[model samples]
Target chain A: MTGGRGSGLARLSLNQKTTNRWSVAEAVQGCVRAGLPAIGLWREPVHEIGVLAAVQLVTDAGLRVSSLCRGGFLTDPTATGRQAALDDNRRAIDEAAALGTDCLVMVVGGLPTGSRDLPGARHSVVDGIAALVPYARERRVRLALEPMHPIFCADRGVLSTLSQALDIAECFAADEVGVVVDTFHVWWDPEVMTQIARATGRIASFQVCDWITPLPPDALLSRGIMGDGHIDFRGLRRAVEAANYLGDVEVEIFNADVWDADPDEVVATVTQRYLDVVLDG
Target chain B: MTGGRGSGLARLSLNQKTTNRWSVAEAVQGCVRAGLPAIGLWREPVHEIGVLAAVQLVTDAGLRVSSLCRGGFLTDPTATGRQAALDDNRRAIDEAAALGTDCLVMVVGGLPTGSRDLPGARHSVVDGIAALVPYARERRVRLALEPMHPIFCADRGVLSTLSQALDIAECFAADEVGVVVDTFHVWWDPEVMTQIARATGRIASFQVCDWITPLPPDALLSRGIMGDGHIDFRGLRRAVEAANYLGDVEVEIFNADVWDADPDEVVATVTQRYLDVVLDG
Candidate 1:
């Protein structure tokens, strides 16, 4: 609010999961107190506050809801599992609509238990997303298909590359479905630059999380603060910008160290690092 | 070699690393006693026995040398580091030639210390391979480019996809440069089917290992015996076979549990599992 030029904070958004301990109101206040213009919301915190009130909270705070955390586990092998996933995603779409966010990120569930049918699991994801398309389109919410790292293909997601996510999203129009460009999941891809360029109008969300090595036993928590890891944030940010993706660059660190830090300090450190590595560096 | 019609063991090759306890002589004896005709050799063990003697041990035992486990660490950022890796790789090539194996598998190296330049590291690998091509061709050995899984891209191999390997390998004759189709490294790729189809005569080796979940702290030892994890061994094997890859199926598990087991029992379990899941399944 100082210069109104919005240079540094203009496209910056704090994804809620970055601060594991912060409640919805706390994260909102943390963003406001840190002078950020937007915040990404996770479903758990939004549900705790009630969807309508969650909407009112950010509205009163002069904050934008950059994206809703997630809306897919669509790759189950059984009919019951598939039906349940579709039903849950419909509710997620409603929540995103109520929260005034156009993007609902989908992590697309991995293989069904005890199953090695990777292709079948991938098909189920496509089918499940297709089932939710009408609902998401009607609500004006974009179903953002996020390709998790290949390591998660067996347990967390079947979509493991931007090309694969684009393959699924192509089944629907851009508004009904799109792809998320998360730096953590995709920075290792050889074709990432070309894929990011091809993403163009289809990039639903752009989340930043650097990859740190000597990965902990739990690979999920290997993501670190921007400047603390190996990701080329400047190159990737420039690629996304060239793709014409004008969206929030949500800082989404998942390291245990950052989670254990104070929310205020976490935001301050991350914001400065983001400006240094992603925006100005 | 009782029934010389190429018994049940004709196509099996036990990679030396699979049984960490087995010396070159021990592994050759174990393979012969278990009815296998071929054995894959690693450089460290070959060096331990003196490369010339390692070759004689397998030869006197009537076992064929399937491949030399590796000859690459070519991604170092510094000139001294690069030179050291090249020197080591050159020695490995000589050992492979002395052992009469036509294929030398290359794990290639990961990013250099404190360097996040993945592209630069990959370029180094390609350049390193090209440099070794003349020497490899003279020895009648093919430099087998093995694209490791993306998870290993940070610390193991920078070539993380078959197409990337083929792109480099295509720059030379098939006999001078080729690829290793390792099940554990590529079973997750969505483009794997097409890439394998495109590999054709370029597949110099076919290594089999399953990927077990909840990877241990040292992810390098995460591989398990066939049928013990999520890989479609038969499917991948068929793809390689269809691509005209007439080579030994080297069982190359690297788990701590496997390493702790008796070498003979380890060989038996892995062979039977390979037959069940990869050959007859």
Candidate 2:
């Protein structure tokens, strides 16, 4: 299983954060054990392993780097604050390039502290991304602007719709900046299917996770395994495919139950669930 | 105080659900005690006193009914399910008319059980409204479709955006079918301000409630006091007012903490919060 030869999942990637307790090495090993050809790395875990070593671990395990988790949170109101966020994103770009991942997912930050200027925050996001595009372009790391669910609009990502993200992405070259089609973030959108098709070559990454309800006190961990939630996985997968997005379909669950389980068993369970919900269902 | 002649809040209405524990009479008395001229009625509370008696209770107290809580759950899957939902809404229309409230709020149901047909559910909502709009129009009760937060799309309301609600509401007369601009549900939309303005005469109600983070297990109770959460109440109120929405600005909060507090104190605190957040702040 360590060879990751085949479960017929050439496009499946085990996003490390889905197994919150796993080390970089553990996730790479588990992905290989489950025949997942790729892995999506979060900044914290990559920093934990040192970028060079994390890259080596995945490469040695014969796993591809699907995408680096994030690169944007530019909703600050001050010039100094904006500069700091852009500088941080430059480092994230460098890390993505060094790790051999072309896509650096951007979860644009929400309203600046003590301010309720959503339009201003969104402007900050566009300007911030515009400022970083040249730097990211130089590094060949495409900034994948991910529009998180509207619930995360306050504290996490202000890009709450694929159309909103795409509108910003339209300001730059598609290869330099693009949008991520994350099922958990976008399944509720009325025009998601149309937007996905419209995204076309601008599709930077395709992330999959189911949206489970009765959201816990922390809504962040409400994501569940595919079949365990309400998303029409097959429908979304078809939309992504129709968009000509050939990137790895990264499984990125944030549920406490999935994270609390054994990484190996968790990987096996999710892979099967993905097949059942996305491919076979 | 029961005269409800003045506290300088002619445009304010205290929605009963904000103080979930208070009965219809208690809510009517509380509103009057707080010098509030209007109160939004829920179906349950009105049923408790019989709609006619409840109507008399508010009228005798010289307080007005701003809007009835709801009349839509039109997304159920079966023929029986759809018919039952429409029938129930018909009764709700009668109650709204009996209560002398022109606006009957609609919290359209989410995807039906064991179903992933969001488009189908949305169609059902439109059909259900079309079937009832004529009846509501005849009775002089306008259907005020309330788009719940996107997070509730799976299990509560499939109509998750003001734009989506407007798209459906446009099929009828603005006065006969309109949309409710609830800050808690729509503050996250990038186009909310623009949509609010575009809604114009179609705006039926302007409900204010703050969007609190780290939602409780039941996201229903995550609403906070105006200043307690991240919403731009002044901004929203400005937009709603600019839309020419001259109806009552209802204060509706659903939180365990708010509900657990003394209802009288809750009303006073919320009314004061409204004065600060919407009028003064």
Candidate 3:
């Protein structure tokens, strides 16, 4: 199962925390310095330095781009917002293609403003993805819809379950559309193993994070470090591997404390903890 | 269907906010004075005033007991904790029986402490209920497993989806276990309507509260009052009725603001909102 220790461990990737405190260049350098193999780059930092410069920076540091941070917020009550989101996703895809990332992760937006129509919002997400799949495929970038936790159903991502995400993925004719299974989002799912099996080769990425000790209303801000929270990362890894998903095991913690710490220390501590908790588990 | 206005709207039931501002008797009197039909009593206040006194207060006010605030937190890792929880549940059953409530709602706890075993915690919940079922049934007090939002998968409630709750309920004998579909917890579910149909006569109660804007970490403290947030109460009502759940729709908001307000005003506002937004919708 180790596939030889070094090679197997090399599959670890870091999803730069979404906060602007860390730049893409700095994040790439941090991963390289930590002997980490890959990094999941967020768009804002890349956009700040220009996509070309960001791509060059990663390439120069010999860091693999596992996935792009995001590409979708497709639910818009109006045509103008919806079209604008699609256009932005197109740019995201182009950026991912330039960076040579494995996939472009989509955090599909929640219900449109002033609407409680969850199903309608989901339909809009599917429609938006279907519209963008052709463009994504043309750029050779896989569009991975990240199913956020149900708490975000009101104002964040409408795709709140892996089954729902897989259903949306099936709507497209090609495998270009896939699902990103993040531990923070899905560790609590009773059907996690079954859904992971259903995902199998269709899983574009597998992200890991821990559930915090004290749950806050804005849960997105309080994610635990790999070993800090109660998620069975080892068990999840086994399930994902059993499902034939050989994607990078991306560490994506969103803890406020971790963010406030030194970025280098954050990367080092997370990488070591991921190895001990997940790989060693 | 209001069943025609002359029949009078189904009376709103106030679930006394958990903050320490009001005693059980005070809440009951406030509901009665506000012309509300029912009150859902929590355990702590019952403990404070004693169950017999709380029951007498409601009886004197001619206030119906819609449901007991809660009964289950059965996901403890230790046998001692599990046994104690079952004992507490039995006490809760006695309290509910004394109050003549429609049911004893169960907030089945999440993963046990120091463990990330979700399935094991779920098993504990099921076994706990199985152990308590005969006692509850003999007392003529129904058990209502209330599925909380997925965000509470760690410390609060593990049964986060309606379908999962129904699955657990199906494991029990007829009427041994039913479900409470709180819109605040499940309005975001993609399978809510389908699960409502599946739960049709098996529903012990229906709860209504809006999903708050900018959901905070302590979600229990941020619950929006009926029609205050984004839930389509009319749609939810139609679905619940379609499922043959003819129970009173209990307004169970745990908002800090509502709790800080005058209990009379809270009851009046919730009653008016229930009539205008839910019944009229």
| lDDT for model 1 | 0.88
**Candidate number of the best lDDT:** 2
TM-score of 2: 0.97
* C-alpha TM-score for every candidate: 0.97, 0.97, 0.96
For model 3, residues B70-104, the per-residue Cα lDDT tens digits are 88999997888988999899999999999898599
Q: Which candidate would rank higher by DockQ, 1 or 3?
A: 1
Clashes of each: 0, 0, 7
Better of 2 and 3 by lDDT: 2
- Model 1's chain B yields a TM-score of 0.96
The DockQ figures for the candidates are 0.70, 0.74, 0.69
Q: List the residue pairs that clash in candidate 2.
A: none
TM-score winner between candidates 2 and 3: 2
* lDDT by residue (tens digit), candidate 2, B176-201: 99999999999999889889988999
Query: In model 3 chain A, which range of ten residues has the least summed lDDT?
Result: A1-10
Report each candidate's C-alpha RMSD, comma-separated, in the order given. 1.9, 2.1, 2.5
Question: Candidate 3: where are CA atoms >4 Å away?
Answer: A1-8, A18-20, B1-9, B18-20
lDDT score for residue B107 of model 1: 90
Q: How do the residues B1-281 of candidate 1 rate in per-residue lDDT, one tens digit apiece?
A: 45642465679999989999889989999988888889999988878879888878988998889999888889987889888988888888888889989999999988888788889988999889988889888888899999999888888888999989999999999899999999999999999989999999999999999887766667788888887778888888889989998789899888889999999999889877876888854
Q: What is the TM-score of chain A alone in each candidate?
A: 0.97, 0.96, 0.95
